[model samples]
Target: MTRILLIGAPIAVAVSVWFGGDGEPQRPKDDPSLRISRTAAAPDPLKAGTPEQQRELEERIDALPPGLADPAKKEIAARLVASAENSTLDWRSQYGVIEDIGDGNGYTAGIIGFCSGTNDMLQLVEHFTERHPGNPLARYLPALREVDGSDSHEGLGAPFEAAWAKAAQDPAFREAQDLMRDRIYFDPAVRLAKMDGLSTLGQFIYYDAMVLHGPGLGPQGFYGIREAAMAAADTAAEGGDEKAFLGAFLDAGRHVISRQKTEQTRDSSRIDTAQRVFLRQGNMDLQTPLEWRVYGETFRIDS
Candidate 1:
């Protein structure tokens, strides 16, 4: 059996062969079960080239204008996400926020909208309980688990909501939320965007998508949306135009948002008005003072 791969400037390829006992290449006639594998082994469309190329990409990303990870840019990212999540720039104010919002995910709470119907809220509480023994929300673990996949408030109600609000007051709880947000969303989004050779604006775009869509690898999840975008246009790391790739990425995100069949999910102003505005204005680096609208309300981040 032989495998042949074609290597290009940014893609890799190779070829291999299996010889018979006679030391000659096996053929269909020589062996009925013999098989030949031919494949197009290209570099990951979402990743840079070789190790040295990846290193260069990382350095270039780090040297670019301060990205989402920068203290200022990160704060700006939070505000941008908050505008869509809470309709306010005061992200910290959302720490104590908890409500069902009729989204079918059960109680949506905290800064990143962890939903009880989804497994993330369970993970968030589990993480917090692990760090701080017997926290206010620990007792609701059973109920949270029970309602992990439905909109039922079977075992959680006012008591659970009150406990959540009370837990929010503790600095430790707030810190736990921040840690989980970064662990589950922020860090992975930013890291992947950088590897894709995206600019600061791209990093923010990825983070925003992660916030709205869970980090799941499913077809509608954050990574799936990215994959769809890559299918449309090569990522910057793949030697494609950054603007084009980002535009495709935004389009993919919008498509996923539109399919949810909910009023709130149907409104993709976060990408349409906000991100597209920046993309249209050619703010790939995401340099501010910036202004955009979401849900018909305008927001700004000046520095």
Candidate 2:
């Protein structure tokens, strides 16, 4: 049986009430001055061209030296499109596209488009899943690679475990679980999306939970990417490479802190109220410390 941590309902309600106010709590607007402040930080490099242009671009990309066709580029393209479409379209239309594409093919296209930073493909996948409650392809592709007991990387495992746990608990997620358990998949872009989604939902609690769960799956889960990045940052810092350090820290911040904020904000009203009161009183006591911690932990960085 899964050991679910059941937070008390009354405490949860109290926290929500304390945070809620007259109108919805306004999130802090992104700082226009900071380049990375906005989620939509930049435009997609792979714009949808006329079919001719797209074909030409894909041919060029495919023809590149193997080393030149980095997966990150494709993933970024997909993300840019996803972010844009999320803003404009209703969910149902998105679902239709995914259904039309069918399994394997739609997912494969999405993976390529996303990795290439193609906005259209990314948006299609995001909207499709949002509209289709049980998107088997979306859910399974990430986990399918793991079944072989090979390619056991840490970053890959964390998302799989979280998804598995969530699917097991929720009946609606059963199809996702089934697909994941029995599919052949390969696409780093999809894996990244799954990780991003899990982080967004606050279900990737392994970071903190690992500290308590002993050095097993959760700790091992973040071990691959987190340790590699941290080591790289340390090496760069030692060599006085400020640029490398900054980039490394930014990546670390994304992996470690991004999910925590999403978890706390699951009940936005309470978090907002707590933040306001804590700021006004300028006190950091137990009653109000969580809010302050969230703010500092999320936004502020020590140089």
Candidate 3:
């Protein structure tokens, strides 16, 4: 399989030109000269992406043939998620990563590259333990917490590594991974899109960002992306336009995806550019018979 290497490594401040390309200080949104201001009412977080209501996109994704990703929602999302994490999609049957890939300290493993330095890895283990008590890794929760977000695998020695491999074989563990992904990425993106009047396509865009930058606020996480979009236009909750707000959000994501030169990310422009294609085509529902390219390779799904 061709490796996309499409996730993570986002650079913040991809595009922050306020006044001009020249080195100029940006004025506050309320700067009298700029005349930029928030909407009359508060920006709504709970209410968003309402267009998906009429779209019925979940049905469309369900209709896709097997092994085709709608980007970030269904089983296909898990496959693509694996592809993004390990540069391959067929890794569900494989396990044990002892080498550090310059990400999350070292030894990133599993479908989503659970690493010692990443807090999500700890959460994955914890979730697995909760479902299957007395699991080998259950005891390591304390050490996992202690070392969360740190590159140090401290107390997590060979036992933890072996347990990680063992758990991957368990169907329960696989289910747990999916559960964690949904809680952290898929569900939030869908709900947020609903509140913001976006469609499944919008929901997927949010999910992609959440997958890389965490569902919560990292330097350029979902909250920051939403914040950037909010700065541009009022959200649906604020009684502002929906299309305009979504455009702002995608633009912000585009900047982050393009933070490095096109060559560095292997032309990560695939993501932002593909979404732009859908937006232009008015495929808000993300209906299938889809085709797109990543890493200069074309992929399609017709069902």
Top lDDT model: 1
Residue 73's C-alpha lDDT in candidate 3? 38
lDDT of 3: 0.55
Q: Superposing all C-alpha atoms, what RMSD in Å does each candidate have to the true structure?
A: 11.8, 22.1, 11.0
Candidate 2: tens digits of C-alpha lDDT, residues 1-303: 010111110100000000012222112133222111112121121231244533433343233332201344322222322222222112222222211111111121111111101122223324445656575335644433232222223233345444433433444343332232112111222221122221111111222221111111121222233333435543221232433433353344344333442352122221233223333453312121222223223321121
Error of 1 at 287 (Å): 1.8
Angstrom error at residue 62, model 2: 1.3
- Kindly indicate the candidate among 1 and 2 with the higher TM-score: 1
The models' CA-based lDDT, in order, is 0.73, 0.26, 0.55
TM-score of 3: 0.65
- Model 2 worst lDDT run, 10 consecutive residues: 10-19
lDDT of 3 by residue, 83-196 (tens): 445455454654444345544344466655556665667777877887789776798889977876666768887888888777777788878876766665566565545444
- Specify the highest-TM-score model's number: 1
How far is 94's C-alpha from truth in model 3 (Å)? 7.2
Q: Score every model by TM-score.
A: 0.80, 0.20, 0.65
Ranking by TM-score: 1, 3, 2
